[model samples]
Target: MTLLPVDEALERILDGVKALPGEMVPIEEADGRVLAAPLSAMRTQPPFDASAMDGYAVRAADVETPRAVRLRVIGESAAGNRFHGAVGASEAVRIFTGAPVPEGADTILIQENADLLDDGSIEATSTVASGRHIRRAGLDFVEGDVVLEQGRRLGPAGVGLAAAAGHAMLSVTERPLVAIIATGDELVRPGEACGPDQIVASNGFAIGALAKSEGAQILDLGIVGDDSAEITAAVQRAAAAGAHVLVTLGGASVGARDLVRQALLDAGMSLDFWKIAMRPGKPLMFGRLEHRNSRNPDSTSRPDTTGTMRVLGLPGNPVSSLVCAHLFLRPLVARLGQRSHTPDLRAAVLASALRENDDRRDYIRASVASGPEGLIATPFSLQDSSMLTTLAAANALIVREPGAPAAEPGSRCRVLMLA
Candidate 1:
């Protein structure tokens, strides 16, 4: 099989994925969830013009004429109260912070800036500025403003913003369920092991962790051996559980014992494509199983969501499986959650010499460090695809496009951050 180029493979996989299911989760549960619809302000912030300080509200012109304004203090207003009567030309009303400004007041003079003289009148010590310490209604936000756009991931600040806009609830995308199945005859569970051919089932754990990091709920199907029936049973189990994506390892390759590719097809799955051009994951296959739906008016028609189960066949090698999950599974999960699935590629300066890349693009494992200079990256000396130890030490991957020229130290490079 001809190898698929990295860019082409990425485009194919990404283009195939669309936004997944959506539901309304309460604000407490909405953190980190993607918004399904845009949220607008129900009411303007600071619903009324208010005093911003604990002081007297008066017109700026009144300060200049009075050594002592002995007007009657008609009434007092706090945050929840409004003065029923407006202040007369020679009258003043006591006010507190957050209180609505009276009809005739345009300025606020802080209590510390004024004094009460012997005659129970305010002495004019400080000159007042126009429009001083007054919070105008709708100053922070206006009604009908789209405060939060659809597809936005809600954080603490986002939740507070929505609440400030008077929204009691929000609609958000439902978390996708990614079912992980690690397949290898040599693989055993973490606790039990004896034979030399047996290896602990690490791929599923890794893939499930990856899925979780991408906001997908994980269902670990454990290890399936080389037997085709076992693989088939696992696939059915994943599908029956309503997994949005199914990831299987080991049997995806073209080895004589490789049974995943055939098992999924034998189980009535419609194949999309297999064998991308990416290194360490060239044997990857993607497809979906058929499910009938009688609820719709068109009984024979398969709804878009029915064909939504994304089956990813990853290489058996541990490092290969993890890389495939990072490059493909995580993004697939993000797309399902309507998140920005694009990898975060940061700018960096090449710390060491880099040779010309081969026909296949390279995702060189590297360690990242921060300093006064900027992000510094160091690629591991070994570039073997099968080594998981090297990948463990890496927090970044230096992307070297195919046919790229040799890069010297201090050259500008793009590094995909793994952390």
Candidate 2:
């Protein structure tokens, strides 16, 4: 059978996916969340003309000239305590930052530009222009103005802006829940005694973390050995938990023990594709499981369920699993969580010569560094799919198109940044 191209496989995975529904969350808990609705200001900022500095509020006409001018200090105006009286001619009001400017004041004389006299008056050392050091009403934002647009990710500044806009709670997209299952008999959980043929399971943790970084909640099903019944049981649990996406590690290839694909089919999943034409990870699988109605629990032998779940089966090789996650799983989670996703691809110069590629598009792990000209990428000599250390040492992947001719050093290439 012919292998599916990587681009086509990804397009199929995201063909009709839509963001999950929205939920109401407190503003304090809204950081890093996507806004579901446009957030408008509840009230105008600086409801009244306010002082922008700790100084004296006076009439601009009273001190228009730069020469010394004396004005009697009438009353004090501090934040939250406004001097309701107006500033008459030759009169000034002591004011602090954020204090409401007196009704008749048109400017502020900064303390540094003024001197306090023993006769309860202030001498203006500099000319006070109209509107100087005064914050007009609605300067920051007006009531009914949208402070944050829909589908915007709330960061530190966004959260603070929402609070200043008088929003105690905000509407944000719900986080997608992903269920992860690690399969294979030669795998054991970390910290446990491993048999001679068994290695510690790790894909679940890495995949789970990757999904989380894209805003998906995780449900780890732990390690399921090479039993068809156990694999089917784990699939049922994921459906029961209403996982938006179910990621399974191992048992995707056509080996004798590759039972994951068949087990999922038995559990009512419609296969989308089986294999991908990509190096390191080729036995990738994708499918969708429709939820069966609970009312007709006995209509089929499967467990009752609600909502559809996208299933992705990855190869067991550590490096393959991680690479495929960056290529596929990251976007799927971002799509569900209402966040924009784009690969961090960059252009770089090859530091050494490389051989020609085959039909499968290759993602060569490489170390990237800044050069005198630009970024220089050097592919590692060893490209084993199971070596996690090599993958860890790599900061980028040199992307080589299929069937490309051998290239010499200094060739321009595209790279996907991992750092």
Judged by lDDT, which candidate is best?
A: 2
Q: Estimate each model's TM-score.
A: 0.83, 0.93
Q: How do the residues 1-419 of candidate 2 rate in per-residue lDDT, one tens digit apiece?
A: 88899999999999899998788889888998999889999989978889999999999998987545689999999999999899999899999999999988999999998888899898888997899999999999999999899989889999999999999999999888889999999999999999999899988998998888888889899999899999999998888767889999999888899899999999999999998899989989999998643422112443454778999999999999999999999999999988879999999999999999999889999999999999999999999999888898999999998898898899999999987
Instruction: Report how far residue 118 has shifted in candidate 2, in Å.
Output: 1.0
Candidate 1 local lDDT, 1-419, one digit each (tens): 56677666667777767787667666877788889989999999889989999878877777765455554566787899888778666566778999999988888877787676576556556778878999999997899989999999888999999889987778998788787888777888888964876767777888888888778888788877789988888887777666778888778767788888888899888887888756656677887776532222212343434455778888887787888788888888888899977788999988898999777667888987885789888889987977888999999999888788999988878899988
Clash number for each model: 2, 0
The CA lDDT of each predicted structure is 0.79, 0.90
Stretches of candidate 2 off by over 4 Å are: 292-305
Assess the local accuracy of residue 6 in candidate 1 as a C-alpha lDDT between 0 and 100. Answer: 67
Worst 10 residues of 2 by lDDT: 293-302
lDDT score, residue 194, model 2?
A: 92
